[model samples]
Target: MLRRSFLKVGLAGLAAPGLILRAQATEQPRPGSPFIVTYFDLPGIKGSRDVTDAGDGTLWVCGQRNGTLGRFDPRTSQIKVISLGEGAAPHGVVRGPDGAAWVTEGGQNAIARIDDKSHAVRLFPLPAGRERANLNTPVFDKKGILWFSGQNGIIGRLDPNSGKMEVFDAPRGAGPYGMTRTPSGEIWFASLAGNYIARVDAETAAFTVVDPPTEGQGARRVWSDSKNRIWVSEWNSGQVSSYDTESGSWKGWKLPGDKPRTYSVYVDDADKVWLTDFAANAILRFDPLTEGFHSFPSDRAGANVRQMDGRSGEAWGGESGTNRLVRIQTVKPA
Candidate 1:
């Protein structure tokens, strides 16, 4: 029996209620700060999480609660929501090289792809007995292969062109979460329950586990810097640590709050580290040079920005708990 898939394209150019204009005044900038923070309310897309640049001017955000993927236009404050099918609770989305939104659709136990132009939906079910992989995040490698992690101890890869996929049981069962591709073309992932990060061998589909210095650090998410260093969000330790792949050395810094709950980490073009702390209800910008952190607390309480991805000047995150999307624009220093 074959699985069924469906697509529902929303009326375009329709502005959701309470949509904040891009030019509107945002949270007041901190003293000598170069970041302007703004939030846009996504009324219908409940539990907006994991966002990626659509390659055009818009962004692709997953509606984890609503089973939809949204294309948000910042300039017009308009969104076109595409349903991923019934019982589709998507955890992460990434814009594939083919210009479609590829999702880790956990609820339906499949990988979904939503075309950028036609909004066509496609589903690729996992092989037999791989049910409930608990798909978490997806990333495209330099070779255009889509790699994803599952909290249920699985790492999988898909060849977009061939529609072929391979899944492997991750070492230390039950916690592969966020994943990223390094500048050097290596794919790495964080194992939250396993308390470590691992580099994926693209060819053999094998994992090379690299342990963090802190035991039980809960390495939840990972992002690769331009230099190929793996920056990890230590959920259990409330610390942001980076492993220098070249030197094989690690450095970590604790978050600001007395009890921070670090959730996500993203490395921008300038190498600035962006992190979210659920305890502080804030997004943090870390400067590796100064070794300091600048906090940007959300205007609304409990704004849980789960995952972040962006372009050159803008950093975007989905405020999952608040049902909103947030963007922080940074001005480059002269």
Candidate 2:
């Protein structure tokens, strides 16, 4: 259904922002819009910070507070919870190339790997003498090395085959939160406190810092499109920004409406940028091809989706505050 909205343009004084405001999803999906959203209500998990596909028709999630790993099957819409043993405040979970859910355990300052099929858990603790790493997210590069971020200002990599580990100090020394590997195999990370995105050389372990135009933009998360541009969710500035690696240029747009704090960002298979807006309790989609915006408000208030990712035209995320996992499918009818 096509719906009309009186948007108050905040940036240009057209009506309302440092950003342009988009219309809310006042009605269900239009006959032509390419999305069919679905939700799986996962009970009994708190602070489901990050999620990833299990590669076997399931999604793996990290229960940050409950100190457990969660698996949600879209087919059955049922949730299976696995304890990470004692001191397991896991923050990030991703399915590694080895076919296991690799997690950044914040409480124990370690990385835990859970077998996707066996549901077995194994912990890989960080080297000692480092203060709590405040582990956040993990990513696997093309070379089969596992990289992870720590909000407490550290980045590291683990070789699953040799069981070898290496840690590096972030240049800014705090807030290395969310990360992604580009199509070029280089790793890029967003430092929420540092206000910039840094590119890491996977082989050499060197960093080249790239700053956004906005001061204190609070780059919370990062993702890459098919073109290899880096997309970032700006928490403090309430914007979504991207850096084109080829051009070395930057572009950004503020979230729709006033004071829309973006908590997470993801680029789907179609390269449409998606973000979670805490202010509206909605998921926002930006069509780069048209330079237009669309909002998908949740059925309930306070979805508070922290991290999101998608593959195979299916996007999945957790309602950190609501104890649920939701999926959005982009359907183009035949």
Best by lDDT: 1
Give me the displacement of residue 166 in model 1, in angstroms.
0.8
Model 2: lDDT to the true structure: 0.80
Question: Residue pairs in steric clash, candidate 1?
Answer: none
- Give per-residue lDDT, candidate 2, residue 309: 84
lDDT of 1 by residue, 1-334 (tens): 1222232222221222222223222454556766777788875578999999999899988989988888888878777777777788999999898898999999888888887877777887777778999999999989998999999989988887777777888989899998999999999999999999999888887779999999999999999999999999999999999999999999999999789999999999999999999999999999999999988899888889999888999889999998888889896535
> Once model 1 is optimally superposed onto the true structure by TM-score, how far is the C-alpha of residue 152 displaced, in angstroms?
0.5
lDDT of each: 0.86, 0.80
Determine the backbone clash count of candidate 1: 0
Q: Report the poorest 10 consecutive residues by lDDT, candidate 1.
A: 1-10
The lowest-lDDT stretch of 10 consecutive residues in candidate 2 is 9-18
lDDT of 2 by residue, 3-40 (tens): 11222111111211111112112224547667777655
